[model samples]
Target chain A: MMTRRIIYLDNAATTFPKPEGVIRAVEECMRYRGGNPGRSSHSVSVAAAQTVYSARAAIASMCGAEPERVAFTLNATYALNLAIKGLVRPYSHVVISNIEHNSVLRPVSSLSSMKTDYSLFDVVGKAQGDTEGVLASLKSALRGNTGAVVVCHRSNTLPVEAPLEAIGELCRKKGLTFIVDASQSFGCVETDIEKCGISALCAPFHKGLYGPQGGGFAAFGKSVSDREIRTIMQGGSGSASSEVSMPGYLPERLEAGTVPTPAIAGALAGAEFVKRQGASRIDRYERELVEYMKKRLSRFDKVKVYFPERSCGGILLFNAEGFSGEELAAALDKRGICVRSGLHCSPLSHRVNNTLSCGAVRASVSAFNSYSDVDAFADSLSAVLSLR
Target chain B: MKKCYVSMSTMTLAQKARNILALNKIKANVVKLTVDQSYGGCSWGVETDCDDQEKIRRILDISDIPGYRFIRGKE
Candidate 1:
C-alpha cells in the first residue's frame, strides 16, 4: 500500500520536509565524517571539528556575531534557559513580554524562587506595526532593579512580533541586558544582533532553518563578556580541562559535553539554504500564502479568525463556531491534514488572546509550503468544521 | 628550521589560529599534544616551522586570537 502524503502545517513546532541539501548533509556527516569533534587530535576528529566550526561560523554570520560567541544546545529552550538563568542577577528583576512561550515563561517563573522577580509588558500596537506603544508599555513596566528584558520576537501560536529594535533601544537606554527568544522568527525574519543591541539571541534550527531537531544556539553580542553570563551546565568543554570550572570564554563556556555533530552539519546546510534562497524572498512568499489562507478560511461564516490584524505573516490562529480547537484538529488529522491545536505549549499567548478556555488552531507556513498546500488545508478544515 | 607549538585552549581556537596564520603567509598544522606536553589531560596547538616568537605574537595580536601560549619542543 502506498503511504498517504501528510499536509504538514505545523512549522511552528518544527518544519517538515526539510530541504534536500539539509538531508544530504546529515547523511554525509554520519556516513563519512563521523568523528568526535573537539575531543581528539586525529585527522578524523580534526575534520569533524572543522565541520562543527563551519556550522558555528554560519550561525554567527547570520546573527552578526563572532564565531566564538555562538554556543550550541539541544534546542531553543535550553538556549533561552542559558540566557535567562545565566544573565539575570539574583536580586534583580526581569521584564518579559505577555506572549512568551513556556521556554521563557517557565524559566522566569522558576527564577522567582531565587528572588529574581519578573514583570510582563504587552506588545502594544503590534497589529498596526507601531513601536511607540510597545516602547511606552515597556517603559511603564520597568523597575529600578530590572536588569534584563526578555521578549519573544514572534509568537509561536499567533503572528505577534515584539518590536525588537524598540525594545533593544529601551533596554540599552535603561542599562538592561536584552535577551530575545527567536524560536519562531530566526530564519523567517532578518535580525542583526549588533544593530539591535541584543545581548543574547536564542533560537532553534528545527523550526525555521529546516534542520533536524537536537540543535540550537545562543549567539551573544560583543557587549556581553564571558564572565557576565554564568554557565548552568558544566562538563568537559574540550578546553581548559585542568581547570575545575568551565572555561572563561564564549562557545566553550556554555557548550558542555559532546555536541550533536550530524544535527549541526544539517543545520549548517539549512542556514546555507536560507542564504541561497534569500530570507526576504522566502518571507515574502510565505506571507502571501498566509494571506491567501486567511482570506480563504474566513469565507466560511462559522470560522472566527483570531488576531486577523496582529499576525506578522508567518502563523494564523482561528476556531470554528461550535467546535473546540482540539476537535476540529482531530477531525482534520483523520483526513491526513496536520495542524496543531489547543494551547500549543503556549498558555501565555492563549490567555492574552482569550483562547485559554478551548485554545486556538494554529497553521504555520514555511518556505516550502505553497498555495496548493494551503488550499488542501482549507478544504480539509472546512470539511471538519461542517460536521458541527 | 625549528618547529614550535602554539598551545590554544580548545580545538576551535587552534583551528581558527591555523586559518588566521595561513592568510598571513604562514603555514601551520593543528596537532594534538602528547601526555607530557598536554597542559590539562589533552590540549591542542598549531605547529609552525617559523619559530620567530615576536613575529608570531604580532600576527596573533593583530588578529585578536585569545588565550594562546607558545611552548618550544619537538613533536
Candidate 2:
C-alpha cells in the first residue's frame, strides 16, 4: 500500500475500498468457513454450502430468477463466454451491439470460426433511455438463421445504457434468446430477468455491487431450459459423480469445479449491502457525480467529453487536447488520481464513438466516492492539462 | 420419529427441496447419500420425518424443486 492518498475513479474496472461488511465477510469465511461446499456432509462443509446458496439466492432475487438458475463464475467474462458459447447454436447467426465490450465482442468473434455468424447493430446516435433506434437496427440485422441476440446492458467506457426491456421484447417477439452482458449495470441498475424476458443475464459482483473481484454470475430466465445450453467446461459438480456427463441442472450443469468460497462470501455481503443501500439510490448518487464531473470538465478549453448530451450513468469519458489518453492518464496518476485510459478493453465502443485513434480517459464512480473526490479529480485533470 | 430420504440430483436441488419443505412448516436436513443409498455415484438427499413423507412428496412435486426418488424405511 502506498503512503500517499489516492483518489480512485476506476470503478468500472473494479471497485476500490470495498465495503466494511464485505471485507469482514471474506476474512470470516477464510478463517472459520474454509470447507469445500457441496462436497461433504460435515457441518463446516454444510455451512460453506449455505453461504454459496445465499450468494446465489441474493443474485437470483436481484435478477428475478430462481436461486438454482444462478451459476457463479470467476467474473463476467467467464459468464459471458459460457452464455454466448453455450446458447448460440452451431450454423446459426447472432446479433450484437456496436458498443459492446470485448467480453461480448470477442466471444461472438471467436464463434465465427465455429460457423456462427453475427451482425453488429448501431447503438450510437440514440438518446438516453431511447430504444427505438436500437430496436430498428437490431430488427434489420436479424437473419433467417439467427438463434440469439447478445448485447451489453451498459457500455463500460461510457454512460450509455442499452434499453434492455426493449431488446428483450424484440428477442421474445422473434423467439430468440436474449443474452445480456450486465457487467456494468448489475447491482447499480435494476435488472429483472423474468419481467424483461431475458434468456441469460451475466454480471460481475465487483463493479457496482461493491464486492471483491473474482466473483460473478449468470442468471438464466425461465424462458430458456438448462438443456438448451451445452456445457463448455465439465468436471465434478459434487452432485453426480457416477455419471461421466455433467449433472442435468441449472447451476451444477454450468458450475464445474470448486467455486471461490471467499469471493462468494464477500459478494454475498456486498449484495446485501447494495440491497440495504438501494440500487436506485446508489445509481442516482453516482449519476450526480458524473454530471458534476462533466460540468467541471467543461471549464477546460482543451477537454473533449463524448456524448455530452446523452444521459450517462456513473462513467464519463473525455480526452484533453495535445495529449494522448495514455499521456493524460499517466499525468493524473502522478498526482495520485486513478483513471483508466486507452480503449478500456472496448475497441468496439471506441470505434462507435470515433475515439479509437487515441482512445479516451474514463473516470467512473461508485457509492464509496464523494463529491470531494470529483473535485480533486477535476482539479488534478485541470492542473495536468495546463502543463501541456 | 424415523426419517425418510428424498434423493436429489445435486446439493443445490437438495437445498432447494429443504427450503420448500421449510416454507410448508416441515423441517428437513440435506444429507449426503452413500454409494449404497445413491443411484449412480455421489448424490444428496433431504432427510425429513417419515410421518410427513406424503406431504413432502406432494410439496416437492408441485414446487419446481425436482427430486430423483423418495427412499422410505431409512431411519
DockQ for every prediction shown: 0.60, 0.81
Q: What is the TM-score of chain B alone in each candidate?
A: 0.86, 0.90
- Model 2: how large is the Cα RMSD against the reference? 1.2
Clash pairs, candidate 1, are none
Off by over 4 Å in 2: none
> By TM-score, who's the top model here?
2
DockQ, Cα level, model 1: 0.60
Alpha-carbon deviation at A359 in model 2, angstroms: 0.7
Sliding window of 10 residues with minimal summed lDDT for model 1 chain B? B33-42
TM-score, candidate 2, is 0.98
**lDDT value, residue A30 of candidate 1:** 92
lDDT of 1 by residue, A15-83 (tens): 998999999999999988889898887778788898898998898888898888899999999999999
What's candidate 2's DockQ score?
A: 0.81
Interface RMSD of each: 1.8, 1.0
